[model samples]
Structure formats: C-alpha cells, structure tokens
Target: MPDAIDLYDPDGYVDGPPHETFERLRNEQPVYWQPMPDGTGYWAVLRHADLVAVAREPKTYSAARGGVVLEDLAPETLAMMQDMLLAMDPPRHVGYRRNVAPQFVPRVINQLEPRVRTICREIMRDAAERGDVDFVHDVCAKLPSQVVGELVGIPEADWPQIHAWSERNSGGQDPDFSSGYSEDASNATIEMAMYAIGLAEQRRAEPRGDLTTLMLSMELDGEPMTDIQFGSFFVQLVTAGNDTTRTMLSSGLLALLDHPEQLAELRADPALIPGAVEEILRWANPLHYFRRTATRDARLGGVQIAEGQKVGMIYTSANRDAAVFRDPHRFDIHRDPNPHLSFGTGEHFCLGVHLARLEGRVFFEELFETFPTIEQTGPARRQRSNLNNALKSLPVRLCAV
Candidate 1:
C-alpha cells in the first residue's frame, strides 16, 4: 500500500513528519532497514536508547567514515567534510573541539546577553513597525546572519551574501530554495570556503580581537589550522548556527500559537521560557536524522549491522519515544526530564548548545515583552526536505505590548 512508507522521499514531510509511520516502525522495527533509491540501504535506529548507544560508541559507529548524511558524497566532498568537526572521528575530533570550546562555554556565552538583548530589541521594534512580516526571513533569519558574521569578523556589508550562501547550503532539497542541490550546494560551499580562507590570510598579517583571530591563534595537535581547514570550519559554524537557530525560532513560535494556553503560561512567567525552549527543541527538533557508518559488524536494538552500512540516529522518531517522554505528542511548556537528542550526545554533541539555548530564551522573552499578542497572519509553510525539518515561511501580525 502506497509502496509502504518511503522515508527518503522529500515530499513525504510536506504535510508534516510521518509520525504514524515512524511510530509503527519504532514499535515493530526499532532497527528498521530502509532501502534508498540508489540500491543502497540504511538501518534507521528509531529508539531513544538505541541512538544514545550509537552516539556513545563512536569507535563502533563512526561519523567520519561516510560523513553524516545518507547520500554518498563525492570523494572530494567526503574529504572536505572530514576536516569539519561534525564528521571527524575521535582523537582528531577531540583535539579540534577543544581548540574553540571555550567560546561556547556558559561563562563566555552569558556575557553576550546584553548584546543578544539589543539584537532582539531591534528585531522586535522592526516587527512592531511593519506590523505584518514573514517571520522566517524578514525577522527570525536576520539575527543569525548578523550575529554569526560579526562573531567571525566578516565585513558587515557581506553579512547578507554570507547568509544567502548559508541558506542555499542547507536548503538544497527544496526546489523553491534551489534549482539543483548538488551544484548549488557545492558552489555555495566553495564561495564560503574561499571567503573564509581569504579572511584567514588577511587576519594573519593584521589580527583583530574576534573569534576569527582566536581560531587563528589556537593550535590543534601542536599545529595551526590550514587555510583549507579553516574554510571548512567556518562553513560548518555559519550554516549550522544559522540554519538551526532560525528553525528553532520559526518552528517554535508556530508551536506556541498552536497551543494558546501554553503561550499564555509562558507570557505570564518569563522564567519558564528556558524550559519552554527545551520543550520546543524536544517536540520539534531542527533536523530529522544524522547518519553514522558502522565501523565493524555489530548488533544494535536486536538488529545486526554490517561494517560500513549506513546507520541513522533518527532524532524525529526518538524524541517521541513513549518509553522516554511521557505524553510525547502533547506540547507542554513544562516538559521535565526532557532528554531529547536534538543537539545529539557524546563527542558530536552540538558545541553551540549553550549559545542556541540563550538565543531561544532571550528571543521569546523579548518577543512577549515587545508584543502584547502575536497572531499568525496565514498558514505556516514548511521546507520540503527530509533532512531539514524547518519552516520556509511563517507569516505573523504583532500587537505591541
């Protein structure tokens, strides 16, 4: 019936996540093997505990072996991804992660509160003046571009181009966003990489007090990062930070409007916004899944996985695992003990976790403080992609507080 459930189809999620299909798979086939269009297949690890185990044992389940996506990348692309921390194996991954981990720690991230608040204040004021805007691009997407560009020391005038490249890099699956993903993504990556390399070259001769300068001064394994290495690193931070932050904002607001009582509770008590952000992440994780290749033949969730086979930690399914989260489907602002794997776990856990949480908490608090009420002007439109579970457009009308 309907060729069973084609999890690989990008069109499958236009309406919403195939929750029924995922739930059935998690129940009957926790270690589900789904075939791909190219005759290859992958084991979808659909349970929360199973994913954690996979994430924990990096030696057994390797992110570096095949990069972190289902599609087989070109040999050049695979090599390029190996340079980024996202796909690097341990030892090397640990070394690279340690170099810049200080910037993301709470102590440093906390200092940005006033700056973040200022950014939100400007955004809210713009929303109030326009009264009607596309929350996705016009409002939510603007913050990450400026914040990330400035953080990296990119010239202020280039923020918009950098953001456009970041959007194309992540939005390849949707036709509205890109005509063909391979060329578009590759071109975007090349341009951004070149820009990063240029920045590194310029900073080498004339350094500035910014993250770019920090990265240049930092050493990995007693050696400085090469220009190519820096380019890949820069792309990972810009695209990853921009895409996920925007998704959280747009998708999170839709979640609030969909449940007014919860929204009211949040507005009544701003202190609860932190927990609300966690719930939003749990309920609507930004990415559907991340791929990891089996280092050796092994067993997981009672299923045998062969060496080099594609294994995906399906975050969308695991976040709703009944065994983990009680009443998982319901949107509750006070979702306690929420151990969602949206930021992942283990070595590959999102390094930007604290910064992302801070952005979410401040964005919502500022939103409610600046607007007495916010209403959806139209139906929310989601990006048509299996990988990026995000909204492409969210129209809203704001009433000033």
Candidate 2:
C-alpha cells in the first residue's frame, strides 16, 4: 500500500509503464506482491535474474497449472490453453516443441526473406500512397497478417478477418478493441478455432506444402494431434504470429522516430537494423508479462512462494533491470550482449523469434529505403492493456523516394 502501484490495473498502463515504480520495486521489493480486483493476486518477479530463474524452473512454477495470463480463465478456456505452447510445461512441452521446432529454426525461417520482403515492399508501397495514415492498422499490421496467412495457407480473402480475430483475442483488455474482453475473446477464439478446424479438414483431404499441413502431419507423444489440438495450435500460431509481429513493427518504428538520431543511424547503415530491432524489443517489448502457477513451495528472489500461487515474470521491468544492463534505461541500438527477456528464455522461448526478427529487420530496411521523408503526423496513442504493451494508433506521414 505504501507505493500505491497496482500492476493489475490496465488503466495505469494507458500512457506507458511506470518505470520509476518498477525501478523502486526492483531495488526495494524485487519480488513484489500485487492484489487484483478479483480478490486474487500475483507475485511479480521484477528483476532480471529472478525472471530467468523462474522461467528456467518450469517444474516448480508450471505454466499449465494456470494459463499464462494474470487473471484465471474459465475451465474450458484453461483446458484449451493447456495445449498451447505458452501453457505447457516440461516433458509435454519438450515433446511438442521438438516436433515443431525445426520449422522455425533460423535456417528455415531465413528462407522466408524473399517472400517477406515482397510483402513488405507491397505494404510500404501502399502506405507511401497514403502519406498520412494510422500506421498501427493501415501500414504496420498488413505485412504480418498477409505473411502469416501465406505461411498457414489461410485464404487471402480471409486475412482481414483473421487479423481482426487475433486483435480481439490479444487486445481484449482494451475496450476500444473488445466490447467485453472475456466475451470478445471467447467469440473470437471460437470463430478462429472453427476456421482452423475447417482449414485442417480441407488440408487433410488435400495435403499441401504449407505450415498448416506440416503441423497436421506432426505427431506428439507418438500420436497424431486431434482436430481440437490442431485448432488450438492454429490459434496460437496465427494470433502470436500476427498480433505480436504487428506490435513489434509499430512499436519499433515509434521507438526509432522518438529517437531521431537512432533512426538516422539506422538509415545511414541498414545493417544496424537488426541490432535496432533487438534494442526496440528491449526498450518497448510487445507483451508486458507472462504468468506461471507455482506447483510447489519454492523460494525465488529470497521470497517464499507457496503452491497454487500465481507468479508473473514482468518482462517490462526485467528488460530494464540495471543489474543486467549498463544503461538499462537508455535505448541504445548497439547494446552488445543484450540479454533482454522479450523473446523469453529456455523452454517456452518464442517459437517465432527468428521470424519476428526477420520481419523487423526487413520491414525497417524497406521502410527507410522506400520512404526518404517520414515524420510523425500526430500523437501516438497506446493501447490500454497491462498484458499488451503496444500502440493502438501511430500517426505518420511518409513520402516515397
């Protein structure tokens, strides 16, 4: 009660993260407890090392016991989440990830450059025509939705609907995006799942060389995945791929524009774009935190955690932990050996990290190449959500060279 900081309140994050509070918490109460409106609370692991420790020991703090969100989900939803890569822990996570891992490796994902570049090129071209636009939905989001659709064989006509579904699911905490976060989520999730089921059935009847078909062909624990499993997996891939990638691109551009010198450096040498992407992720991470349920009594950051307690690894705080980085608060694109936990660490590390990185690098390179003159047309408005640290609207005016 002393600090009056509530991590659970989405309104508190409407403007931006309370860094001063996090800085104070990281120093004083590295392991902070926060109460929620629903009479339940979570242990906020704020430091860099503590987050890594909690993430590494998935057995003690299980992602499957409860879904990866701060709030508890309904029974049916929790069950569906248990099958997601975000919720699985240990042997099961290991098994499923192993089968799907090869598809996302740097080597394989790198091959997506030409196709991805073409997509970005077209997107940039369209944005260039509209000199003034809301970069969030109009420009930044197009590439990911299109690229993910191509990757999963989702029909070109359905990409807009798929993107909307993903937005509703991930942006539920924002009332502007979702009328009722829970209801919208349930509806969007079911709609997407049904679509995935139909898509899987279609692909099963006529196999193709696409990610969806590859996923269908994969088996977990010596058994082929059920249609339901395929549906859940499809939701995970599309939502994670489309939503997070779009956020990264939008937020990354906003970060660069905020720091014109950095943007200038990036334009001068396109090679620096990769490191710029890493810095952007570190400074402006897409998701704020991922939750885990403690399975047994354990001590983390010198605080005792009991069984059935919800624990959240606050990536926003961890990325800026002074103990980890020399200038944690500073946004330096060339921050070497940057150990930001944006993509996360260990077993549940983001499956699309390589793809995200590729998109960031290519998108920026194309943006700078195409738009010789770009400036902020209006103030950027951030999404009102503790879970999603992203922009709801970024107004920019760009002129093509």
TM-score of each: 0.98, 0.98
Best by lDDT: 2
Clashes of each: 1, 0
Model 1: residues >4 Å from true position, as ranges? Answer: 1-3
lDDT, each prediction = 0.90, 0.91
Please report how far candidate 1 places residue 48 from its true position, in Å.
0.1
Candidate number of the best TM-score: 2
TM-score of 1: 0.98
Across 1-401, the per-residue lDDT of candidate 2 in tens digits comes to 38578988999999899888899999988999998998999999999999999999998989999989988998988888887888898899998998888989999999999999999999988888888999999998998998889989998999889988999998888988898976798789989999999999999999999988998998865899888888999999898898788889999988888899989998999999889999999999999999999999999888999999999999999999999999898999999989899998978999999999999999999999999888999999999899889999999999885
Candidate 1: the clashing residue pairs are 372-401
